[model samples]
Target: MNIHKISAATIARTACLLLALTNQLLSACGKPVLPIESQTVEQLVTAGITTVAALVSWWNNNSFTAAAIQADAEYARLKQKGE
Candidate 1:
């Protein structure tokens, strides 16, 4: 019966429907257009090595970040204890 309530509900429902349609379209478009052939054993091994190196680099960076976080937390705890 209230015009404001009706307009707000309509807008909310339209937004939700649009978001769902957009997600569906995006997912559908994300598939590769062409089929890929299987790689040779040598190619697979090289790819595996590359992946491992990348993972190791990521782990090193993450370890540095984690260590920094721990150091910061310890510093904060000590500051609080002193105060």
Candidate 2:
């Protein structure tokens, strides 16, 4: 058997990348209309904000929240309002 350990930063970055790709893929004809560079930048920003918010919440409540989940919900809300 083989085993590997990944750091939290790596996991967070990977999760953000996957989220961005999935969002793009599901948006238009199974294709990404936006450039890959922009998608990456946007995802990184979202990841950074979510990380900060999660850390603040953890510091206050001693619990961690799922960043991707909240991001998706917020995205949907924004989209519905045509923002």
Candidates in order have lDDT scores of 0.74, 0.80
Score every model by TM-score: 0.30, 0.32
Off by over 4 Å in 2: 30-83
* Residue lDDT tens for model 2, 1-83: 89999999999999899987777777656666554677888998999999999998877633236886687789889999999
lDDT of 1 by residue, 1-83 (tens): 65544588899999899876776676589843333345664787889999999998887634358788898788789999995
Instruction: Give the distance in Å from residue 40's predicted Cα in candidate 2 to where it truly belongs.
Output: 15
Best by lDDT: 2
